[model samples]
Target: MSNIIARFHKIQVQDGVKVWYREAGAAGNPTILLLHGFPTSSNMFRNLIPLLAEHFHIIAPDLPGFGFTETPENYTFSFDSLCESIGYLLDTLRIEKFAIYIFDYGSPVGFRLALKFPSRITGIVTQNGNAYEEGLDDRFWGPLKKYWKSYQSDPVFVQSLIPYLQDPANVIRQYHDGVADIESVDPAAYTLDIALIQRSGQADIQLRLFFDYQNNIKLYPAFQRFLRDSKIPVLVAWGANDTIFSVAGAEAYRKDVDDLKVVYYDTGHFALETHVVAIAEEIISMLAENQGY
Candidate 1:
């Protein structure tokens, strides 16, 4: 059993936002930056960290508006700004060369980081992190696309989504949906998410960020170009059953990356919740083969 205990911290980044992050394993070991997705924070990696800490030094941060991270009310909550905050954190920590574990909203942020610092990235582990237009599931994105197009002009329409955003059941569904064994999911995950979403001004942050997600879609080609040009060793261990980001997203990596391994789990969006061990093993094997760590 791994003896490494995860440590929690809050650091003020260059932008003045206090970033809350989880760190584990030895500092000298190979680093893995774990970026999480929508409605969830680094907490999603809580179970996965201990499993991989023995082999990797883990850095999982709560994005500006999520989890324990403190974001000023006036802070701009776009994917670009999110990446900038994370970049500052890395620069402050002097983390030059490291792998990225991207998922959901993290996908865009991580890809942007890769584009900015191509040489600094050692490898990428994308779990339901997408970069292709076709990878987006029409059913899940249909309503979101409408919001993206109209949010600027339609005040009433934008306000209409608030009720759905405030619904605890919707948050619960994000954890329960597409999972064969619902009992496998820990309730504390969504429970904490629900509490955080209810925080003052948090709903607005999430809503604005949701709209800003359109920008991520616009950068899909750039992200793809980075993969094709960099050809960094990529491990695509995705949840085949994820409705938010379909299996096509997982397969899309094969076209651009020359060194890629795709492993599909029969789970949902948060695959780590169910298949943490297998994913950790795959990550270790991939890093060993590529980075000799």
Candidate 2:
């Protein structure tokens, strides 16, 4: 498995931001673009990508400010900017149509790419990526919501959250949030996140994305509209116990897409960490059953 995973590389997008990506699979096969969520990177997909590579081309790029992507000193960390950089990378690769695998923060960035090129998205796989208002539960998003409302005038909110995310206990909780066997989860998951966050100004950028998340919420209707109208192949596989993006958010995609294939995993926020085998199978199956799959 280690030998199969493509070595990571960096590319400068239109904005001059260096995007680090893990690309694998056959060049002629259907392409799968894996977009990561907050506090993690494409490394999270290390286990799943190779399994799918035998069937399709896979590209998992670290969004600017996270993972190996070099966080520019003054780069804008908004979702729009993140999408723009990815969009540029796609163009540079000459990729016109591909399937998008979105999770958490990847939802907004991937959804934006879908909107930008509605016809280009052959399909979409949403793994705990929420686009409906119902997905906004109280437990995890509550405090972040407060931070969003107050960060403009209250520096205290940002001051508190930055360290809270860096704290070892809280960071570990993110990895074990919905896992049934917390002990089985690797320590590397949280430790890797911590090492990256401590990189000079990484914490500040993470907080920026946490605040900008509200803007993604504002675009929920548009994202839903894209889903409803495009009606492309959409698979919703969610971690049932995730407190951050709840199971309700996972089911809400049905309002716009009636034929959506929704599956609930007995896990938490980072479902892939524990359910990679099942999740990979679902994605591979969906791509085959649906058109352009």
Candidate 3:
């Protein structure tokens, strides 16, 4: 039995956002930066951390304005800003080089780092984190794309989306969308997300990221190029039932990365909730292959 215990931590980065992180495993073991996505923080990695901690050092951080991470006044919430902040956090911790485990919102943030400091990324493990245009399907992004059109001209239009985005039921839907068995879904996943959504200015911060998300899409080709030229090993573990990012997104990486392993689960966006054991097992093998263990 692995006796590792995940510890919650907080670190103040260069610009003063206190990023809350969870850490486990030994100090010198191969490191994995586990990053969570929209509406959730490092909290999403709760079940996976302890599983991976026995063999690898796992660090999962709540991005600025999410979870326990404090969003300082006047801080810009753009994806570029987030990448810089995450970079600072890594540097402050003396993490010279580490692999990234990305999901959803983390897809863009992790890719930015991989491109800027390709030498620092040992490998990448993506769970429904997209790197292609097809990943942005209409059903999930149609409304947000429309919001971007009138967010500048019509405040009324932006307000209309807020209620749905903030609604707990809607958040629950994001968690349960593709899962065939709703009974297996854990209530705490959306429960914690809804709590985080209730924080002051949380909705607006998310809206900023949503608006700036187009910037991420613009970098997809660049990300693909990095994967190809850098020859970075990748593990694409995805929920086959993911509504926002479909199975096609998982297959798209193969266009650039040849050293890739793909696995699909029957769950939805929150695959970890149901497939943590299986996912963690694959990640172990993936990291070992990268390190020649």
Cα lDDT computed for each candidate against the true fold = 0.90, 0.87, 0.88
Residue lDDT tens for model 2, 123-223: 88999899988898798888988898898798986798877877777878878987879987878887888788778877777888888888998999999
Query: CA RMSD for every model?
Result: 1.0, 1.6, 1.1
| Predicted structure 3, TM vs. truth | 0.97
Q: How would you encode candidate 3's per-residue C-alpha lDDT over 1-293 as one tens digit per residue?
A: 36788888888896668888899999889889988899888988888888888788888989887889876799999989888888988998999879999999998999999989999998999999999998877889999888878889989889887888789888999888888888887788789999889877878888888999988988998898989998878999999988899899999988888789999999889999888999999998988655674
Ranking by lDDT: 1, 3, 2
Going through the candidates in the order shown, the clash numbers are 0, 2, 0
Model 3 spans with C-alpha error above 4 angstroms: none
Q: What is candidate 3's CA lDDT for residue 44?
A: 89
lDDT, candidate 1, equals: 0.90
TM-score of each: 0.98, 0.96, 0.97
lDDT of 1 by residue, 1-293 (tens): 47789999999996569999999998999899999997889999998999889888899999999999987767898999999999999998999999999999999999999989999999999999988887899777887899988888988888988877878998888788789999999999999989888888877888988899889989998998999999789999999888889998888888899999999998999899999999998999999655678
